[model samples]
Target: MKSCYLTRPGLLCALGADTDTVAEALFAGQQQGLVLEQGWLAHDHNAAVRVGRVAATLPILPPAWQARASRNNRLLLAAVQQIMQEVERCKQRYPAHRIGVVLGTSTSGVDHAEWALEAHAAQGQLPEGFQFEQIDLGDPARFLADWLELTGPAYCISTACTSGSKALVSARNLVQSGMCDAVITGGVDTLCRLTLNGFTALESTTSELTNPLSLNRAGINIGEGAAVFILSAEPGAVQLLGAGESSDAYHISAPEPEGLGASAAMQAALRDAGLDETSIGYLNLHATATIKNDAMESKAVDRVFPHGVPVSGTKGMTGHALGAAGALEAAFCYLSLTDTQGRLPPHCWDGVADPALPALPLVQVGQQWRPGPRYAMSNSFAFGGNNLSLILGGGA
Candidate 1:
């Protein structure tokens, strides 16, 4: 398989609007990015739950693309703006048809639909600006293709939380199949009334900052953001070495109790990367902080890296961005792999650790890994047992 090089990544989440800002804040232990607020859902005005909402103003869309306007797309636009210069260079470097686009998203314009319904209920008519296609799972991809004016393959993945990570796999396939020379891939998700209320109904919404692998852990603090990457055949500081995907179909919302599915994904990733467990320099865990998820993931991590390796869950700093999480965490891995500072992102949680879970080597603040060709692994597991793991680094 061809090594997929992540030439550049653009990410915006609760932590900050760019990679450098987010990295500084993450290692600096600045947890003010996530805030507790109310009125996220229309009916639940008083629910002041902790959430990681991006505090940046998104770029406005052209009037021609107004119909496709939505917060999800806006967030994507913000991320794209960061890499526009590099992307334009790619446009000049590759064939127009050889550049593709693939994005992952769970909520796309549902927020607009929710408001349109409210306007309809109050005024008894659909709003003039609301377009049905804006709610499409693929609109983000379409918008990007048009914005970039490229004719390459474009699509979106919506496999719940695993959607983002799987997008990297899909983009890699496109390039490996000789369909494209380069692909812009990543994920974006916006907070909407539907998702907020649905999670609340499922009792997965947390009221405080989540404590992953902690006894007092409640549930996840839902967040919103976008992450975009310019992937190409040309090598860079960080390369996408391997990606493993599996669907265990364990449950609708709950992961398999024993973490067989999660373990399979991790093991597959290590095998795909042509590396053993000890080769990975750092691990970006998909620690959602939910009791069952933390427990299951712990077992899976313990099974895969028995000898131990540095691990950390960045969700505490950015909250859980859900569909965009995989890409966001992948960015964290990409940063660590290429970072000259050799700083590993610390586990951003309370010091209290849960004794029931396996004792993994979680990184502490200001910790640095050994020097070498850095390899970092990131994991993303979602509903319906959709699991994905990507290994990023210079190959051994």
Candidate 2:
């Protein structure tokens, strides 16, 4: 079997536009979220919840390109462009046809759809302003391919929150299957009235920043961001290691009580990695801070990693990027392994622990691990029991 490795990864989140800003924020333990003050929604008008919104406005593209893309696709474009900036360096080594693209997104172009509807209602015609090209799930991938001028395989995975992780898995499969030699895999999502009001209708939006594993933790706060990674078949590459996906069919919006599907996904990822539970040094948990979701995740983590491994959730800092959450969190895990010399980022806002939850050792402060190669895992569980886990290890 061929092993896929990450060559260069780019990130743009609320922490900042690049990896340096994100690293600085993580190391300094500074929180970047703020309450949404003004937006196009009723619930978001005076929403009290703090969101980790990107501080910089998205860069404007060519007018032609801008007219045919949605806000979320714009974010994805930014992240992909950052990665392409490094492609010239790799071009000397890999063939262009060997490269592929696999992206993860849930509500792709829903924002555009909403705008189209409003424009049609107001003007009594399909809005002359709205672009029809951007209202598709595959638009982001297609735009990225055109931007990079690559003619390889292109795909979009939309497994809700697990979409990003699944995209990574797809990239690995493409390389291993000899379908492509290199790939770009990641995720992007942007805040919109549709998602905000939808989650609000579900009563899943909280009035404050979430507290994962906290006794008083409330619901989740919706956030937006994008992350991309370059994967290649080169030796000494940061290997994908392993990945697993499972579905519980337990409920539409809630995980099963015992975390059956979550556990299966983690176990399968470890098995695919040819590793044991004890070998995982750190865990990037999918702690959205919601009651049922957090509780279910806690149970799953306790079942797999009970040896007091350092565990934290970046959602507290990044908010839940929904469709992009898996990719963003996986990028954090990959960065945590490569940048910090094996140290894991701490859980930034853990004020009180939940007594009813499992008693696993949660690393509340940033701590460094032994300097060397080590293994870490990232978990992403979405609505409808869609679960995905990725195992990443340091490059040789």
TM-score, per-candidate, Cα-based: 0.97, 0.94
Q: In model 2, where do residues sit more than 4 Å from their true spots? A: 40-49, 91-95, 340-342
Runs of candidate 1 exceeding 4 Å displacement: 41-43
Q: Which of the numbered candidates is closest to the native, going by highest TM-score?
A: 1
Task: Quote the lDDT for 288 in model 1.
Answer: 92
Q: What is candidate 1's TM-score against the reference?
A: 0.97
C-alpha positional error of residue 345 in candidate 1 after TM-score superposition, expressed in Å: 0.9
What does candidate 1's lDDT look like per residue over 1-396, in tens digits?
777788658989998998788778877766687798888755668879788889998888889989978888989999999989999899999987899999999987788899899999999999998898889888899888988899999999998898899999999889888899999999999988788788878888787898888888888888888889988778777788888778899889999988899999998998998999899989999999999999999999999999998999999888888889999989888776666677888997877888998998889988987867688999999998988899998622
- Alpha carbon lDDT at 71, candidate 2: 82
Instruction: Give lDDT tens digits, candidate 2, residues 323-377.
Output: 7888888877777777644456788665787889997667655586655467889
Give the per-residue Cα lDDT of candidate 2 at 292: 89
The true-versus-predicted C-alpha distance at residue 255 of model 2, in Å, is 0.3
TM-score of 2: 0.94
